[model samples]
Target chain A: MSTRKQEFLAGARNTFPLLLGAFPFGLIYGALAVTSGLSVGAAMAMSAFVFAGSAQFIAVGLVAAHAPVLIIILTTLIVNLRHMLYSATLLPYLKKLPQTWRIPLAFGLTDETFAVAIHRFRKNDSSRFKHWYQFGSSLAMYLNWQLWCFLGLVLGDRIPDASGWGLDVAMPITFIGMLIPFVKNIPTVVCVLTAGAVSLLTLGMPYKLGIIVAAFMGILAGFITEQTGKKIQVEIQV
Target chain B: MTANEWLMILGMMGVTFGIRYFLLALADRIRMPSPVEVSLQYIPPAVLIAITLPAVILPHGEWHFSFTNPYLVAAVIAAGCGLLTKNLLATIACGLAAFFAYQILLSS
Candidate 1:
């Protein structure tokens, strides 16, 4: 196989597991966007432009609530701030990539894309193929997302309403599936509890500001727990 | 005109692209604080739970702390199944089953 083909193959292999999650999630997004009163064009366009699943869900909720557009924009910012970290993690590997390859790759850096690509890069222990691997993984995920989302929009009306089809269960179920893998550390456990409590407490807040509050509180709680752990580790060494 | 909507979407896209690219461009010029790194690591699980729990338990916009709410029961089962199996499909199936079963029991 040619070097390019090899890189693409490696990318596909790395992203296959991520696609398992993205397919259903994108379907849920498409179905929700349609049922939430978005035009099929708008829904598909959103997948093309925004491409962030959770942010799109929040946008649908805001649309349903008749929220001001400014608030929607602000909420999207806060919710997606974590993408900065993804960009940060990939920066070292991407330093040598030309602008032609960088912009599209940056747009495709969703949670699953970053996870699979980073995992591959770490496992490979080589920077030579990092960009190629990332490109491949992200391309697969991007294509998978667009296809499922389009399918969902096309078949959206046929699917039963949220109450009838139990489609409302998708988000929570997906989240639960994600959470199971990360509860190993005490810091993570504390972060979940603190964020949950904070979110519930602030549920009455307006314009989904509660999400922002919960996010900040959760981050603080996690940092404290991590620091405490590190301090204990140091003392133990001493 | 509703053309404004498209403009708004495009403008928002610009803003988003700017934020994401800002750090990508600055990655070499600066180092993130230790606290910032620690906090970013915790964001996924925290945000996921924050978004999920309310939707499941507060389907009616109020806390219905009872077994009568089928969605909550289904969510708990789904969460357990997910934790045990670590599969999205399995978790969603359990949730769907619990939701429909509770709905049936409620009607009966």
Candidate 2:
């Protein structure tokens, strides 16, 4: 097999665990979207077009709340603002690629894809087609999302109180798994602690604005901790 | 779907794509500020914690920080497993097992 093929398969294989985690989430989104008043077509369309899982879930909740269109849109913007950072971090590796590749890759970019692809991109590999790995992950996520969403739409009613099943807990667990490895240092510990505290304090913020606020607070805390650590090192050296 | 819902979905699509595309499209032409670039390293950890912390602690959208909260228990167990093993599979498996076990214990 070609190197591209290897990268692609590797991407898919790595993301498979995440796909399993998202399965119930996609199903819950579909079932709840319909039960919350979205038509079958619209629910599927949202899954297809607005592919961000968390954002789509929040948007559906807002829809059920009868929130104004502008609020829903605004909420989505804030909730997904993290993706801006994602694109920025990815820019270094992907900047040289053509728009055709970047566009689809960007469309397929999700928390899961970002998680899988960034590792490969950060690797010291000689493969020029690392983008293919991202492509494989993105395509897998997109297709996986659509398939589960459709199944949920079809079998949603049959599942009976599907939203109460707690399958969504898989996502948070997976996130914990992803995040634990990052809490190795003082700065990262500060970052995670601050983010957790701030999110809890701001939990009542509308449209889940608390998430953005907490994320920034965490980043700021981490940056300060790092800077302070450097300053202490300088003082000790003096 | 109604025209209004379609409009909302389109609006959502546009905003989501625009945010993701903005930086990737202009990456070569533009240089991020030093602070923004430096802080980028913290984005993954910060955002993931921000998203998951509340969900685990407040599984029902209500405060439940005690050991009685299955989500909290599971998360603690998962964190331990993750730190010790540095393995995703072990973390998730341990977490779910703890979660189900806690659920059964609490309900019983």
Candidate 3:
């Protein structure tokens, strides 16, 4: 096999575990999209085009609630703000690649791909094919998401009340599962607590602005905590 | 899709792609500040918690903090599973099973 092909396969293989977690989420998005009155084609198109799982779920909810187009766009933009961080982190490594390679890779840089790609980039290998590895992981996740989404769309048509069945609860559970491993420090704990409390307090906000507000507040709180924690550590060292 | 729905999808397409493509395209030109870089580290946990809390705590658009709120119960169970196993599949499985069992018991 070519070196590029090997890197790609390795990337896909590394992403397999993450794909297991994403499968159910993608399926839920598909079913929920249909439940939210999106046509099958539109729902599939979203999975194809937008390709961001959390944003897609939020979009479906906004659509179901008859939110304005501007609101949906803004809400999704808020939910996807984390992508900028991912982009910033990966930028240095991708700077050498041409636009042709960078564009598609950026388009495929989902959370799962970012995790896998960053890990690979941090390795001390001199291979020029690292981007190919990212491409592999991205392709694997992209294809896996599309497959599960299509299955969900098909099943969604059969089960009209999929949302009512409380399967949607899995989404929050999944997020909690994803969140716990990251709570390794006071800053992270503070971030999660602030975000959770604020989201609960702002539950009645219009157009789901509560989430956007809570997210920004949480980020701010965590940022403050992280800076203070560093200062304390520096003082202790002195 | 209606024209409006199509517009929303297309609009989302443009915005989502725009965000992902923005910084990477300009990576060579702009350097991220240290403060912003530190803050970005918290974005994932903050955003995920912000999104998840409302759904788990207020599933029906109302505050349901009691035992009848299967989502809250299951979310707690899922968090426990996450802490113990630190495994995604295990956490999700435990959560779904807890939710289904709660549904059955409550309905009965």
Native contacts matched by each model: 0.50, 0.76, 0.78
Tens-place lDDT digits, model 1, residues A72-162 = 7777776676666567767666766677677877877776666556556556454465677777887887788899899878777787763
Model 2, span A145-233: residue lDDT tens:
99999999998988899998777788898898878756778999999999989999999897678888998999999999999999999
Which one is best on TM-score? 2
Which candidate has the top score in DockQ?
Answer: 2
Off by over 4 Å in 2: A234-238
* Worst lDDT 10-window in candidate 2 chain A: A1-10
Point out the higher-scoring one by DockQ: 2 or 3.
Answer: 2
Residue pairs with backbone overlap in model 1: none
lDDT of 3 by residue, A10-52 (tens): 9999777667767777778888887788898899998899899
Those runs of model 3 whose alpha carbons end farther than 4 Å from true positions after fitting are A1-7, A10-25, A28-38, A57-75, A111-134, B1-6
Question: iRMS value of model 3?
Answer: 2.7
lDDT of 3: 0.83
Instruction: Report every candidate's CA lDDT.
Output: 0.72, 0.87, 0.83
| lDDT (10s digit) by residue, model 2, range B1-108 | 899999999999999999888888887897878887787778888888888989988888888889888888898998889999988778888988988888888899
Using TM-score as the yardstick, the better of models 1 and 2 is 2
Q: In model 2, what are the clashing residue pairs, if there are any? A: none
